[model samples]
Target: MRLWLGLPVASALPRAHLCVFIPISERSRKDGALSLAALGTWAQEQLQRDAGAKVRFVSVGSTAGSPLEPYTLHVPGDEEVGYKRLPVRILKIWHYLGQEDDCDWVMKADSDTYVNLRGVSDRLSCFDPEEEHFFGVVHAIVPPRQLREMWPALYFGHGGSGYVVSRGLLPKVGRSALPCLEDMLEMTQGDAMEDVIFALCLQRRLDVQVESYGFLRPGGAWDAQLAEQEFVVNFHQARDELLDRRPKAPLQRWLHWDAQPPPLHACVMVAHPVENETDMMEVHRKLRADAAAQVLALAPTASEWAEPERMPLGLGRAQCVPSPMALARQAEVRLSAAGAPVKAFWTPKQLEQLSQCLVHSLGKKRCGWTDIREQRYGLSYWPPAQSSDACAEACCRSGADCSLFQYRADEGCWLGRWEESQAVASDKVWQGAVKVW
Candidate 1:
């Protein structure tokens, strides 16, 4: 991971690369002196101690610092509004690539962000860096009232959260898109936000595909339980205080394949003979109601058997046999040969484990509603319900597809699809009930 820091600065640089990047006016240099000293010290420590991949910290600004002259790259721009800074910095990186093009990805971030570099490298390995790709926790931005007419749809990654651009796409952006971008910046009188400008250039102008990932951001509310998982990558708006507070874990801790438990892939071999399609449907419904059973295909007749030649059990067409016992025996043999753990009889404990595994593998925990209410979107209406409990029961009985229900005191229940139910601010009379896994 050849990581380079394209930090924009106005006044003094921090000792650590992680220090906050707050551009200061020329008059405030005295106030920034101490922070600059701290930054120099931190830079020395990083140079001495960090034995992994070498990270090049290049500070970008209008003028080079007296002390940090070696690390600073002087780009022509006003220090106050560095609108052209990013594209220029990126172009400079591309120029550096002309000399040494070994870097797989380029990360553009503010100094206040705490980046798990190993986590980023691991995530990038999943995609082809040779292709035009962009990654970030994407945010849909509504333009300011004054700029709304000129810029209608402004979708960008929150810069505080940070974003990554592939090396292959950077050169193209610099060559083809930068001129248009600079014009936009001039038009906005430097008011266009840097992240938004980058987003517009990549998506609207150059047509680069931006993929969103769930990397944590500062002040963004996330499931506290899930945030503890290894998948979370960065923390935005981090302060210097974190250096002493957080533990020094191995960088490899952040690098792991995001492997979820495999889905419960098993076939329910019906041992009892079925008369018709209705009988088969009823049997399928009953088995599916158990939750543990993900019955992919069914053998409803004695003439139908799960073929061992199919090996993995459910993928191929079902085979016919003389008896129901033959079908069960065939299913057991085939599933066992395919390396799946086979049991002669499924105990309640085993079934429960299977159900739990299915839930974990799917990764979406069902949402529950108690006193909450939503407006205007209902899939279907049911008969008059006396209470919320009755409405909930109705939703449950409506099969697994039913996601929610809204019930009025004297009226019936409204069955709703999960996507349609958007919560409204006003609380009228209706009570809502949502299915929880």
Candidate 2:
């Protein structure tokens, strides 16, 4: 059976290939030991048990303490004032770890962040350790003139989000970039972010290849909606309470690629006939061409798409209907027959009702469960309610495959294909709609 959409089944990497390092302080050792360190150990054990993937996790701290005695690697630095010396400490750890152990990739993470090692292994499988590759959630620095004197341009991964460096780039960075950074730190009196400094070393000095990945959760208030994401690799700034309650939230099922089977293409029936024959002809031509190209690129036959099991959650074959109302009705039929998730185009009137229901539910501090058939439904977005109702309607009308609508104050409206299983309590500003058929 297929695991996650688009991603193929990946083979496990050898235990010696991957290493994860977490930077902790002496003061926060207890909390770190109970939270991040415990989670990392659990993740490693789980992956080893489930997928036969071996991963090493280590804690890097400056001070010697009982809490860190088991797996801690004591580097030469002052633990109390380590923030200013973070870049130096990181370099020292890299060099020291390189000498002590043989690893293909070295990942640096914060004490509060939770990592999904299986996802990390899967992502690393795509690149070679010999290549000078840097992987992380990339962020560009925009200026209002604070440190223009030290560096001209700056781009770096948010360190709380974590980053990975290949074995090939380590020596180059140590040889060339570390000395320059040391001189710069001495001249500037050490007030730079470690992530920015590292990125400058990789991108500006060595000109290594940087690959951005979206596995890191954005920094914001906690949203339970994120638990539904199929490919989330890490969560930063997670609350201690949440982690205590749901420790397994960071690791989802691993996605594996399955062999191609017979294609089952859905027939599109244009319920609403267009006025101009030429316009209809052009539409048909474009659709046919696009479908043919997709089949040629990924499938063995024109009639076959990836099996429904392999498709992304809340996605299925497309169907054309006469109007938003007709589409909703058709969706009801599909939802009732197969009891599968279905998407429907919504009219402005229907969208307005959804928005009002969401607002009302939010105000009442209750889940926004709209009545669809005999059951209640809610919106399904990661950040939840990304846009306005008007924007959502426009998206539904513009695209041939939009099914759900959500609107939030200041954020505007968003269109999505999948429906959320349940409405978790969210910000009061968010609103959503589900098909009521």
Candidate 3:
């Protein structure tokens, strides 16, 4: 069976760790309304207004663009734009930013996309920056014909919408993904899809957890109504469709303001395919205006406005499971704290008692528990727990169905029930126990 996991539960770092990366093409830069110059200028202005915000917008592309903007980075690659060279371009991008250590997360957004820092921050608040995670719109579709043999059922994150990589995994992309480059090119016969190859490298090589959020969508319009119902963070293909100039329909009447020219709402975090400078500005202006209006609405009086309380990270999602990496960090902290505070409490009598307890520790703890589960199973297949004790406690309180508990250093904890089995020698790696009373 295919094992699927939910989103992250622990929030170790703040949203300041997220870095926004956008890829722009020369064709889009020159002719398309969603040019690098337009998007970069707007993003730079937004960053300027919020001086304290550390969310950097780094745009990457070939060398043949106009003098690069402060937020834009030019990588050395052929200026060709298509699926054939996308993998190389993406590799170049990763290689360029491989040494990024300040931010714990990198969000790769399209150039035409208008990203809302607040929205992105909210969506990512619950995730741990130290852990390896890949988030985007996940599609379980077939790869190109040439790659069918290599990847039978390819599950990839759609890059057109946007995708995020945690700091623990992003750095390894450049250094680790190089070995598979030539093989990947040959497998696809030079027609490589960036998102597919990216997913493969992360899942197969780095063992990063692939997560999908329902709120993160591909093509949709943002308005007050849709924003309220769906917590949409990324709205792809935000450009207008067909403009009817035929007799009766006026510009305002003909345009679907809700979809095409997106109506400004505080809920929208990122809107893509804004194919023109004018639409980009319009969306930007509406966002700013709505933000100011919200501030005014929240004020007790016209002149006096209380600062809004910031929601703590990791509280956005309801039920969550802490990742293995997060559990390891927690274990380290617990170990350090356990020793630091009791340095002075070790008197002569206490030391003697401690030595005695350590000597008889194994027999005492092992008295009321059986290692039946360890003889038949391992904790590698179980979900992660904060500690072994926590895992056993969870099994105890998990009702009659939970008869066995297993724990390991790397895998955390496992709880299950199976037919009664003969007792076997206990193991250090997979410690399985069940309380008698």
Candidate achieving the largest TM-score: 3
Tens digits of per-residue lDDT for model 3, 291-397: 55565565436433232122111111111122222222122221012111211111233222222332232222232466644454422233334577756655554
User: What residue pairs clash in candidate 1, if any at all?
Assistant: 14-39, 15-38, 15-39, 15-40
Q: How high is each candidate's TM-score?
A: 0.40, 0.45, 0.53
Tell me the alpha-carbon RMSD of every candidate: 23.5, 21.3, 16.7
Quick one: ranking by lDDT, best first? 3, 2, 1
The Cα error of candidate 3 at residue 224, in Å, is 10
Candidate with better lDDT, 1 vs 3: 3
Q: Each model's C-alpha lDDT?
A: 0.40, 0.42, 0.49
Determine which window of 10 residues in candidate 3 has minimal summed lDDT: 334-343
State the TM-score for model 1.
0.40
lDDT of 1 by residue, 1-437 (tens): 33233434333332221211222233434313522432333223342233121233344333354554434433233233353454444434433432323346665544333233333443344355677766664555665667666766544555645566665675676565446546665776445566776677676667764544322222222323222222222321111111122345422222221211111112221111222233223333332232222222343342323332222222111111111111111122211111212322222322223223333333223345555565546345544335677556545543454667777776556665577656666546667766764
On a 0 to 100 scale, what is the lDDT of residue 170 in model 2? 63
Off by over 4 Å in 2: 1-15, 29-31, 34-41, 44-68, 76-80, 98-101, 145-153, 215-437
Candidate ranking under TM-score, highest first, comes to 3, 2, 1
Better structure of 2 and 3 per lDDT:
3
Screening candidate 3 with a backbone cut-off below 3 angstroms (N, C-alpha, C), the clashing residue pairs are none
